[model samples]
Target: MKKLLSMLCALLTAIGLPGCDYVNVKELQPGVSTAVEVRQRFGPPQHEWRNEEGSVTWEYSRQPEGAECYMITIGRDQVLQSIEQVINEQTFARVERGMTPEQVRRMLGRPASSQYFQLKQETVWEWLMERGSTLNDPTYFTVSFNPEGRVVGTGRYTKLRP
Candidate 1:
């Protein structure tokens, strides 16, 4: 169901590129590209998730030398809004106000754990990840949501390898 649509849009953004250059990914113009055009370009998305706003984001990951993943957001108008690299600090920093829980999940994968604090009336989702270094020290990202299910805040920490 959703997977098929994601794929359709991946080719939506990724289909036409002979080389699939991530650098040139910026070429996808938000105001210009239609979902059909995107499907025709990229091929199929590697993953897909729908935001609370009812719009879908299609993911495309390039493996081997280029271990990069892209999140392409197509608006209800079926026009593109943005293309983002999901695996970097810059992306992590973009976790901002009013984003939905699903958007965060789509960007960072599942959290390592989550907790609901009755005192604060919020649910916190945490992810344990490997930061900049390959030494395997754990990095953590926590996104907090209010009772209404919207993102209210975020946190991050790095544990250096000993």
Candidate 2:
């Protein structure tokens, strides 16, 4: 009986306790915060879709070039209605913050307009890209969010002159 109890406890501990400490984005809840809170904690979303009803679909890039970490659906009221955070490449890309201008240009190619501005007293840069382009061959971009999760700027790049 003692041996059996010990084994069960060990198994339970192994299964319930995580071996490492990491902030998992999967556990975020919407009603817990406003849209601004979500942005502040997770940084800028890789992409967002806003509906006529004012609901927003936020796609958080899992990697700089791979899957999406989390897909959160928020209503116009600013509450979390649904959340899906499974590892799938179709949802989002893994992107990192604090990239230099040259590095961004190299990764995303040349921009149609590279603008620099000050917002809330912070310096931001935007590189607008053309549409129908891939990460391997990107073309369209209305705006790029900083790791801080703000629309710092916008730009675009195309084979033909605009």
Candidate 3:
């Protein structure tokens, strides 16, 4: 059953339907949309961050299949502040050595996957990126962390999708 569901999701994503419940952010108004409306559209968020000023930002990740991660911020007055896609090249450039996993997650939402290399004592987190116009290959942005959980480096690579 799980395998069937996974395949179904992959098919939907491949056809350009967003994997995150097919969220349509275009219909949502920034300052006019209510928290209730946002929740109704996107479903419950994967994680929520409360700002120092009392605003909240919710993360909706469509990863390991789809290429976008959204960060929707709601103001203290309960109005939607802004909707941002955080998995682009700009956000990837912000990741630096010595940054913690929490920092990376906050900047890029959640990664698509993570792997631990026992021999190298390193952990790598990868986020699948949107394919460029010139290539249909799968591209990934990776952040490698040392055993102490601090980022050591960042990388980008493309893989030919089968």
What tens digits encode model 1's per-residue C-alpha lDDT throughout 1-162?
655754544553454332544424644578787876665556666677787797888876553223355678888888887777665777778788788887787776556568999999999987654435575556666789999889999887775776
In the range 47-136, model 2's lDDT, one tens digit per residue, is: 676767888867653332222245566788887766664332221132235445544432333333433344644434323221223444
Question: What TM-score would you give candidate 2 relative to the actual structure?
Answer: 0.35
Which candidate tops lDDT? Answer: 3
* TM values, all candidates: 0.47, 0.35, 0.83
Q: Which stretches of candidate 1 lie over 4 Å from their true place?
A: 1-18, 92-105, 109-162
lDDT of the candidates, in the order given: 0.68, 0.45, 0.83
What lDDT score is found at residue 42 in candidate 3?
71
Minimum summed lDDT over a 10-residue window in model 2 is located at 16-25
Error of 1 at 114 (Å): 19
TM-score of 3: 0.83
After superposition, which runs of candidate 3 have C-alpha atoms over 4 Å from their true positions? 1-23, 131-135
For candidate 1, give the lDDT: 0.68
lDDT of 3 by residue, 53-120 (tens): 99999998888776889899999988899999998988988899999999999989889899999998
Per-residue error at 9 for model 3, in Å?
14
